[model samples]
Target chain A: MRIELAYFAWVRERMGTPGETVELPPAIADVAALLGWLAARDERGAATFADPHRIRAAIDGALAGPDAPLAGVREVALFPPVTGG
Target chain B: MIRVFVQAAPIDVGAEIDLHDAGGHGASASFIGRVRGDAGLTELFLEHHPAMTEAGLASLAHAAADRWKLGALTLIHRVGSMTPGETIVLVLASSRHRAEALAACEYLIDRLKTDVMLWKRESFADGRIAWVEEREDDRDRAARWE
Candidate 1:
């Protein structure tokens, strides 16, 4: 499936890309699996996902956990939480 | 009534807030968030996607209305470059009792921090610029409301 991935804050800095569209392999069924697969693609991805606990994910603008299904989501954003007041 | 605005100028929090007491609300609570001169920060810039930011603020206001039986609520957030000690955001809530108004004000700010689409960039004295990262404690605070 094709998905648009977005990054913010530290994740965007480390990845050097704010957003991108990509085709995911069939083995990637959910957010956790997708992160694991991406980490193996390059050093930048590996480092970004190095500490999942500090990272947060949103599927189609709604908060999602690592186990959340991404079957119907066309967009997923990853960031270092939010600090806006 | 709830009011939300995003502007480029300084926010006159007190002037923006006025209670006529059409029904005689007995309590009002206001919160103002200012840019802090972080010892580590030499300069700061704020950037936001206009449409997304408006949507974020509207959602926050709606949530506040749904959660609290409020007489009035106001939320103002500024966009663009801001200096240290400048106002960044303000929230006001009025209710029939102090407890509701105070709790609503706190809830609005807390949720805005986590759910808002706004972003801040800080420049350190060493010539490094970076986006502010969200704190775990802020998320925990918002979670309590959920």
Candidate 2:
């Protein structure tokens, strides 16, 4: 499946790009798996996902957990916790 | 009526209240968040999701309206780059009574800290730049409403 991946704040800075549309391997079925794949893809991803505990995500514009399924999701936004008021 | 805005433009507090006041409310409460020039900070940058940020604020507005007897509601958050003393966010809630208006205004601002898809980066005069981390206190505040 092909999906648009968005990175925010420092995540975007470390990723060296704001977002991208990438084709995913069929085995990557959840947010956690996708993170795993990305972390193994290259050095940048490795460093970004190194501390996944600090990472947060939104699947299709709604907040989602690590175990959230990406079956029919069009976009997945990854970032650190929000700090705004 | 509910108005939500996510823009890089400076927030005009007077104009926003004037428009919101047209609802003929008896009580109006608002919260304005400005970038503070703390520790020689020079600039503050706000980054947000193109679509989700507005949607999230709208959702919060509706939630407040649903929870209170609000006559009108407005929420605005600025994005991109901003300097010290620039308004970062404005939330207005008007109602028939002061109690409801106050509670709703507080609710919107508290939830905004944790619920919205916006991030803040602070740049110091000493050449240090860092993303503001989500505080435990903010989480605790948001959790109170739940």
Candidate 3:
């Protein structure tokens, strides 16, 4: 599946881009798996996903856990924990 | 009534308060968050998801209204570059009595810290830039509502 991936804050800085559209392998079925695949893809991904525990994800604009399925998700946002207000 | 706005322009607090007062509720409560100038901070930049940020704020406003029998509620958050002392966020809650409005105001601000899809980056006078880390206390405070 092809998905739009968004990076925010430090994640964006590390990834060197704000967002991108990428094709996913069949094995990348969840947020955790997606992170693992990206980490192995290159140095930028490696640095960004080095500490996946600190990262948070939103699948199709709704907060989702690592185990959340990405079967039909069109967009996924990855960022550090929010610090607003 | 509920109003949620996310903008890059400066927040007009007085104007917002005037509008909330027009609602004619017997009691009103508000929370205004300003960018702190601590440690020689120069600027505070807010990063957010274009669609998700507004949706998150609206959800928080709706949750506050449902939890408390509020007559009116307004939530505003500023994005983009901001200097110290500028208002970053504003929350206004009104109800027939004090307790409901006060609790709703507090609840909205508390939940915003952990729930909103907004991130703050700090720029120092010494040319240092860093993203603000989420505080454990913020998570603890949000958990209090649960």
Best by TM-score: 3
Q: By summed lDDT, which 10 consecutive residues of candidate 3 chain A come out lowest?
A: A46-55
**Residues B1-146, model 1: lDDT tens digits:** 77888888888866787542315678888898988888667666666543556778888888887787888888899877887888889888888899988998899898988887777888877888888877779988999998
Q: What TM-score fits each model?
A: 0.83, 0.97, 0.98
DockQ scores of all models, one per candidate: 0.46, 0.92, 0.95
lDDT of 1: 0.81
Off by over 4 Å in 1: B6-9, B18-24, B46-56, B136-140, B143-146
Which parts of model 3 have CA positions greater than 4 angstroms off?
none
Model 3 is docked with a DockQ of 0.95
Candidate 2: Cα lDDT at A66: 94
True contacts kept of 1: 0.67
lDDT for B9 in candidate 1 is 84
lDDT per residue for candidate 3 within B1-146, as digits (tens), equals: 88899999999999988776526678988899999999999999999889999999999899888988888998999999999999999999999899999999889989999999999999999999999999999999999998
lDDT, residue B93, candidate 1: 83
Best by DockQ: 3
